[model samples]
Target: MNARSLTLRNVNKSYDGVHMAADDVSLDIKAGEFVSFLGPSGSGKTTTLMMIAGFQHPTSGEIRLGERAIDNLPPHKRNIGMVFQNYALFPHMTIADNVAFPLRMRGVSKPEKERRSREALAKVGLQGFEKRIPSELSGGQQQRVALARALVFEPDIILLDEPLGALDKALREHMQVELKRIHKDLGVTMVYVTHDQTEAMTMSDRIAVFNQGRIEQIGTPDEIYFAPKTRFVASFIGDSNIIEASALGDGRFETAVGVVEARATGAERNSRADLLLRPEMIRIADAAQPDRRPFKIDTTINYGDNLLVIGKLGTQAIRMRVPGVDARRLTGSSECHVTWRSEDIHVIA
Candidate 1:
């Protein structure tokens, strides 16, 4: 596949010319990079993707694929492959034909189309199923066919909009692995639009977090999860304890958790800040630790692999996740001592 970089410079989209579906959206996707546009519903992730794929026109600003401006190009003219959530395969056509549809549109010869279709199908692990119709294949297999169809033409970049959404949890997880593997093998530039945070975190090399038609942040999974710059990003990524605090200068804060300390980011004295404390960072206090907060247990939910303990540490409600081994010891207990390293606390910028 011929992978190419994608750039958007101040792209904006509005349906009624009054309300912006995508506001000043700009992104630079590197050649062969797998980037995900991730957000909650109505946050403009899909809107931005549609503009990139030429499905929706930007009211203002520009889009560039590699060195050329593609804002004026039609969807089919863009040479970008797209996979939809519904697995848009022809029901009556055999899997081989479905995979070859794009080639047929491009006027590829029969022998060449058959060979490329077979290779594409093999890349998605659907080699022998080419003779079967869509109805005869399982949801996962049908999705594979759709993926093969998209890859058969070897487009510059591929856009997938919630492609695994129709499958069950297990199948979806399995497909995530498969997609990552295929991406590694093909080295094609891919832009995946998904509302699923975990899906984006696990699959994408970089994630563009969207909210209210704007990009909140774009970074790697560790950077997004551990070092969120805004309250929205901190709260949306995963389990967190966002503590309101008053900066006390020199990286100290008066918080509900009491005198929380953090690395200085040149915070203004007396300014307000939000402290992001991940659930997994907190731990049951050691016996010798002098400073231990009294916790009142609210509930304990066991997931076999890990135990989620909801409780109150003084006035602030807190969630703590402990290893499953601790379940037997901590399950029925009303309260337990808790502590967290001050360095683990992140001050949301």
Candidate 2:
């Protein structure tokens, strides 16, 4: 299939013509790139995707697939593939027939439809199950059928809206791998809409984080995790330690940890801001270190491989993640010396 780039220029949508659901959203998705739209509920991620798919027309702005304008095109006229969260399969039809439904609609010959449907099923690792009905398959199998149906038509692009939301944890993880492999094989431009941060971080080549009807930041996983542009991005994507601080000039900040050094990208001289410190970035320090501060342990939660220790770092509440092997050191102790590297601190003004 030929891949096409997707672009949205100043797209805006409003239900009551007052508050915007998608406020001046503009983005350019490269051809054959895997981009995930990640955000919480009602954050405009799905609203923008629906506009791209032509399910909901934008109140303003232009949408294009390649250089052709598709702002006014209907859903069927765009020839785009879509997979929903519920599978949306025909319960009474055979699996093969269901997969071939799109081809049949386009007036394809019986032999051609059968051949394409079988190929699509094979791509999703569902070969030899064409004769089975929907009820005869498991949740994951049904999802595969939906994907085959979407791909059998060889549309310009594929869009998935929380497609793995219905599966269990193990199955969801399995499908994530399968979906990545299929994308690699076909090199199809996929726009995946998901609220799960881990899913987006694991599967996407780039991620667009949406919040409050706009994209907060768009970048690779490492950039988004380490150099977030806003406080919301820092707090929402993963475990973060947002600490209040005042810049002391020359990349130094007077924080609760006592005049810590950090990357001063967002901090200005003599200005107050917040610093983001990831839990895993901190570690236990050596005893009798004069510069080291004691982290008062108030609670500890074991996560099998790691331990989350909640404590007070000099009257400022903070959290730290340490290896499970260190849990023994904090068994009966209420305090421990802790320290972090200067480069790991990110300023969020």
Taken over the whole model, the C-alpha lDDT of each candidate is 0.92, 0.92
lDDT, candidate 2, 255-280, per-residue tens: 87788888646456889888999999
TM-score of each model, in listed order: 0.98, 0.98
Model 2, C-alpha of 262: deviation from truth (Å): 0.5
| Candidate 1 C-alpha lDDT tens digits along 1-349 | 8899999999899999888889999888999999999899999999999999998999999999999899999998999999999998988899999999999999999999999999999999988887989999999998888888999999999999999988999999999999999999999999999988889998999999999999999999999999999999999999999999999999999988788888776779899999999999988887789877888999988888989999887799899999887667685799899888878899987
- Report the CA-based lDDT of candidate 2 relative to the real structure: 0.92
Kindly give the number of clashing pairs for every candidate: 0, 0
- Candidate 2 clashes: the total is 0
Model 2 worst lDDT run, 10 consecutive residues: 261-270
For candidate 1, the per-residue lDDT at 349 reads: 74
Cα lDDT for residue 70, model 1?
97
